[model samples]
Target: MKQPNPERTPILLGQIDTDNHIATTVSLFVILLVVHRIGISVYRLYFHPLRKFPGPRYLAATELPYLYRNHLKGDWVRDMVGLHRKYGPVVRIAPNRLALDGSIGWPQVFAHRGANQDEYAKVRGFLFPGDHEAIIAAPRDVHRRQRRQLAHAFSDGALIEHEPLICHYVSLLVQQLAKRAENNELIDIVKWLNFTTFDIIGDLTFGESFHSLDNSEYHPWVLTIFETIKGSAMGRFFAAYPIVRPLVVLSMGADRIKKLQEHQIFSKEKARARMAAGAEPGRRDFMTYMLRDTRSGEKGLTTNEIEMNSPILITAGSETTATALSGFFFYLVQTPSAYDYLTKEIRSAFRNEDEINLRSTSSLQYLQGCIEETLRCYPPSAETPPRVSPGGEIDGRYVSSGTILSVYQWSTFRNPQNFRDPDSFRPERWLPTSHPLHDVRFDNDNRSAFKPFSAGTRDCIGKKLAYSEMRLIISRILFRFDYEIAESQDDWHTSQLVFVIWDKGPLKIKLKPRTMTE
Candidate 1:
């Protein structure tokens, strides 16, 4: 080895010093990061505002547990049922969120806050970003205006006017099922129910039907809606962790975004066509009532508003109704006694299928009870609709402003405190006290806790239409046929994965024509 030169030795020492300095800085940064995370965990567990609340320490310490159960597992509804059971009525589901069962929670969180207090605001992130505000995502003033404008269309009078159109689709549904019955075929009742409701809503919203009933298959637009919902459910994960939004967007790929855009464009096109066609005489479609307000020079919906609300109407009006009806049959067929009782009630109430109109079905008390019980057991919209607290009292506890709160419908409906035999389906629980079928055991059941359509100013706008469709279709189907659930689909109701709405699979059933006895 050559003897070291003085100049070279200094240069080499300087290089080594620089390398050591970099390594020291990196090590210091990592240590600080770990310490900071530990500090946060300690604060969240022992000193945070929500610390007094009861929940798993892990859930209170970080949002990861809640996210894993809800976004990753897609079984938050079932998990909520279990959470309430373990933790009591109120559960600290996340670091800053509280999930309350609906008894005191619904009225407190969703009810009017009184003239002196501000109403709890809707959670903004829940609504997907869009150019125009539909009623579902509108700010309070905008929501009030939109609700006012569309009120007439969803009113009792409008439902009466729209009855014939609804009846027409129910007839088509019966006809389609009749064909399947002739062959004694196993039908996916969920798909057929979806077809009927989508066609009905498509016609009402666009002033023309989707022809799903005529084609005996799903319309392309309807399929696009399902795809959009799945994508939206995935997008929620990003919404919860905005720091990862860019990565999530990239991962969603261009195709999904393009499909969503295409769905919006199709909705806009249909709405434009309906607007161009002006109201026809005797036409009682949803557009007719909405456009009537515009023609009368009232402050009705604008063309843009109509375009924006059309898709909301399609999804909200169709999917929910179909889900409820599907749930009704799923539970009904499993409980043979309940099924037979409902069949007798419906068939005896109407002499023939032609007589099973909306009005006729409305009077079938047991039929209504069965529908109510289905809503309780398998609500169409099972997820929590979070609201930001306005520094008010909820369930007798003072909630600070900016805290997220929700009365999760699934938890509320399944809570044993809210219903006797909560896991069991008993339509008799919904019957009037004096009614012959009424069971006194359910007399103590907290009926007020059942808000399947939700409550307050923002309750479902299409509730009347949904009930009308369910009543007519269920009554007619039961009147004309007797059905049994396919053995493979015994777990249909319990085995679903919910993504915003349910990730429903086929609900297979076999139907036979009711044998007429003189």
Candidate 2:
């Protein structure tokens, strides 16, 4: 009887043991994740591959320093240049990223053209309906195909054809600013710059206006887009790590995502609508120009491609021009000499508001120099543009595949090798001659090193339009007004995005109408 009881009763205990083992294993994994992240932090501080590459320890270990500087308006690029001066050009800016502030890394860095936002299946960039192409986020071949499809539009003839559209918007900007001056009201010059650029880009890309200029209140879409970008200084940190993104997406809901979806729908539908409307007797915009290119099987762009390309064009079209103008205005006001100089040039050139045409405004050399200096001093995107290596060596050292390297314009322009008084706003240095303080030879080397437009096969397609818009708007504004900063706000330095800068809050300045005559 005792033997029988022993055999029958014992088996149940084994099942409990197995379940405990599973529980123990799960506990160990959770503990490992905590340990692994800690190890990563510690190793970065000590044994990381790029440890010898100098930088502030916090930035090298993680993205926190970089993100914090952007939020704080402490100017990371400028800080980076300072660091490079202390450390060296080849500094580790983040755990997996390197900042090559000097000339060692160009051909090996940006020449490769790595994958863009579209390549990140886990994340998405702003999209529209007519195009699925990702100019800023795709493989080399994809960019080539897309750029080729749109290249003809940027020709001299095309730019000439696009002049009237440029002229019209500049006129609108001048009109609105003049009206404000007439009323003797203070306005945020930065906000108006936002309004002007977005509306013009909206009209050209989707054949619709964001109406920001007309409303004087930001369109919801414009606000959303700008907010997304505005948050990019921090957002890019979360974006790059990806470990914390799902938590964020879960927290923010799909509202902004849904709005982006709507933009794509709007882009595609507008393209279709524009095509259907056909040629009219009045005038042509970018839509009709693009329509003439495709004309065959669907002949225009497919909805997916339009969805991809439209928002990009709008982004490229709006971002740089707005930033340059904001920087232009800020510097002009900050350095009254430059402002007075520009004003004199504009006043001398134009007899009235009507005389500020696209052609008429571009004649002033000092104004152009100021615009260039503004871009150099305060570029929209100040960070190193992360690009892949071309399966080669940088400065004769071997580089592995998939290495994400970069050249930041802010840091590059500030480098002693590139400019004299690198931090100074000397527009005269941009002239054709060499400067005594700095060498200006970085403008056009065989490689795209100092590129705010990026370089090589993947340079920004909106460069021509961006220049036209910035020049036209700035010229007209200077031609029309004498502005002094509002008493309440005294600071002008603004925040930066991943590759763009958001200067939206306010540059409240009182406008005194210029006589339009010298």
Candidate 3:
């Protein structure tokens, strides 16, 4: 400061002035950003195209409301039900999204995928990373192509060949449950069902069994699948705010990302191996169709398609089936009379465990009714599968192109308008009108609204397989052992947190072998 050089004085002052200007610029920019955000929010609330839509003021303005209800609280399904109850079928869930219910929503959004009509495509956000390449995520045309190649494998005829694989694993499950019964043990039916279904899909898709039932422990990859889904469910929260994607990924932490990467790598390796093996002529598995795809011309799946879709198959095949079985058993143990009726139906229908097969089990009417009721009560898709409206009318309202529409399965299934006494476990509703057991009161419920597997072209591909697996596993267990809700788990259904799928808690049940000799 003493005797500062004359030449340096101007430079120092210039530096100070530049720093002040930068500070002022940054402050002004931040203020502008705040103002812009406030303005946009106001517009969204009162002046956006979706302004007239019925919804909470906060949700209509920002995603924060739905995120708070779904991601933060884990009561998203319940919250949606409440919302629809308050706001009617068409409620604006976000600034650009509407959740629809009733008969028209299904046919219009999911079913109307013709060249001449509005094809509300799959919401890309709901699917995996592969965009149109992933089967569940694939666009309409890509889905049609991919589905063509894979359709053979999931076909009723193909599943007949795959039945041996299912039966083989279900046999192992029976053996394990029989062991548990002998020990008079309290077993988590959900965990065991997961093990069975995972093993079957592992074998069917990957061309090898996870051997989880054989080992009595989940495969490391299976554990990874569960972890990945949890992360994905959480990731969906941040996905609602696309601007924060990178920040959300960073916040999800490195360990989670690494784990998800591991899952992908693991799946890739299995799929690659299966592809290398090629189809074994008559081998009837998921890989077989893809392996022979080149010969199928237009219907063939590419190597990349096969690799990505195998995991999707495993997930769609295994998780949903296990959820249905677990949910059925959960309701079964709670409703004593329904439980008694179903047990009688299954045991009486089959003389022995060996007598039950895919074809034979279909005749068990009461068992089928129970399965239907379970699907209605606790569907595999606990949340809505969001669809997009590409500028068309839906539920009597014209929606702009890219407007999101979702008919939440949980709310639609449970809505009083859809079903009478929707909360109660009543299998009688599913019984045919010709059946003496059928109820007119139950019949009065809008039967058309109960679409657990969903509807239209995008409906579940593995539906038949799912039904077969559920029927076989449930029938086997009921025949061999009598089960009751374990004392520790009360109100387990309400306690479950809904992710995209259910983060199902253990369904603890106490099993006792039926008196075979008596």
- Model 1 residue 196 CA deviation in Å: 0.4
Query: How much lDDT does each candidate structure score?
Result: 0.83, 0.64, 0.83
Q: On residues 1-518, what C-alpha lDDT tens digit does candidate 3 reach at each position?
A: 58989999999999999999999999999999999989999999988888988989888878787775675356777788898889998999988989888455776777746688757877774645664687787877888877777888889888888888889999999999989888889899999999999999998886789989999999999888877776665666767666866775676565665676788899899889887877773566788877674453553777898888887888889998999999998888888989888888877777788998998998888889999999988998876568777898766777889887878888888899889999899999888888778888976788787778888887788899999999999988888888888786777888888776788988888898997542
Query: What is the lDDT for 506 in model 2?
Result: 71
Mark the 10 consecutive residues where model 1 has the least summed lDDT. Answer: 123-132
Per-candidate clashes, comma-separated: 0, 24, 0
Candidates arranged by TM-score, highest first: 1, 3, 2
Ranking by lDDT: 1, 3, 2
lDDT: worst 10-residue window of model 2: 118-127
Please give each candidate's TM-score: 0.93, 0.79, 0.92
Task: Give a tens-digit lDDT track for model 2, residues 110-138.
Answer: 45445552221111231222222565665
Give the per-residue lDDT of model 1 (tens digit) for 453-489: 8888888998988998999999889888998888877
